[model samples]
Target: MEKHIHNTSLFSKSAALTLTAVNVILFFITEAFPSVRAYLSLNSVLIIHGRMYWQFISYMFVHGSLMHLLGNMLGLVFFGTAVERKLGTKQFLILYFSSGLASGALSFAVYAAAGMNHVFLLGASGAVYAVLLVFSVLFPRTLIYLWGLLPVPAPILVAVFALIEIFSQLFSVNSGIAHTTHLSGFAAAWLYVKIRMKKSPLALWKEAYRK
Candidate 1:
């Protein structure tokens, strides 16, 4: 029960729901609510005053379309639940947010370095990718149905995705997806989990009691 409580709080259903709701709202903002869109975007060099740093966090909840949100959230639903079950909700939330931050930072830096100022990177793919990567780490042997068609081993499939993202970035993609950000988030999440697992609670407790 304690474990379950921890998971619930950390992987709060409300958090996911709120995130999805906002993405839905983002669609409207981008379509109907121009004024709202201005406030919600990652406007680093704002012409007028608004939430400047909101982009870092806000991008996680604002996806481009229903199809986009579905793809990301689908990954979250499958892999995220497993990770949340293993790490509990609180730890999962921390990983999710941290990956999102890293993903956004990398995207922004890359864009700026390339002099792509007007473009703003947005989406929860960064965080979702983080969850999926962790899931791959903890359960590398897990099998995933590729688009519910062919069954492929999780680790191999994930590797393929990573490779594709890296290669596709070289040749301009017509798909208009932020595959780079997804990979960046995955890498960050992988590092975070590695650091986190180093000091398990049992190890910490033993160390504390030893001293």
Candidate 2:
């Protein structure tokens, strides 16, 4: 016998689509205005001294470059749809925004503590990474293509990224990428899956390994 899962989404629209649209619109907005990126991007100094709290949410919408925007949006669209469908709109929003906000907070703290108050971190990579982590955990056996070529299991792919981020954070590597935010997103996603789905990532990994 097979079990059929019925969706109980309050909204008919996809959360993934809404997120991608907002990000694309904001990217163009920053490009046209230019100055808006300063206001939208996460700046540790403004957040701490100037008290620009809203940047926490806005930073996720702005990307540094066209490639950066495309990469994050691609991840969101590919991984987010499945996660949103399983969690529904409300829960999906919770997971997405919460992870993004938490990543911003982590970035702010790390930069401020390091005396790098002028540092700015932008893009939806953190939130997208969180969504990817959750999707991989839930669909461990799902095949994911690396660089549109070699096939790798979703869980293993996500695990590789997680390990890379952990190493980068530990070594204080300056790769112009916010590795701490990536780790924070992974942490937030792990907690959400554990609490909401009552499934530990360890167990999920073991199950995947057995296969």
lDDT of 2 by residue, 1-211 (tens): 9998877763247879878988899899889999999999999889878898899999999998999999998999889989888888888899999999999998888888888876889999889999998998878888999888999989888889988898887887766899988988999999988998688887877877798
List where candidate 2 sits over 4 angstroms from the true fold: 1-12, 172-174, 208-211
Model 1 lowest lDDT segment of ten? 199-208
Backbone clash pairs for candidate 1 read 7-89, 10-89, 10-90, 11-89
lDDT of 1 by residue, 1-211 (tens): 4554345453245445445555667776676755655555554454223437777787777666678778887777778777877887788888889999898888877776677767767678888888877787667667798868888766667678888888787776743777778889878876886598774333433444465
Return the clash pairs for model 2, or none: none
- Evaluate residue 41 in candidate 1 and report its C-alpha lDDT on the 0 to 100 scale: 52
> What is the TM-score of each predicted model, taking all chains together?
0.78, 0.90
lDDT of each: 0.71, 0.88
Q: lDDT score of model 2?
A: 0.88
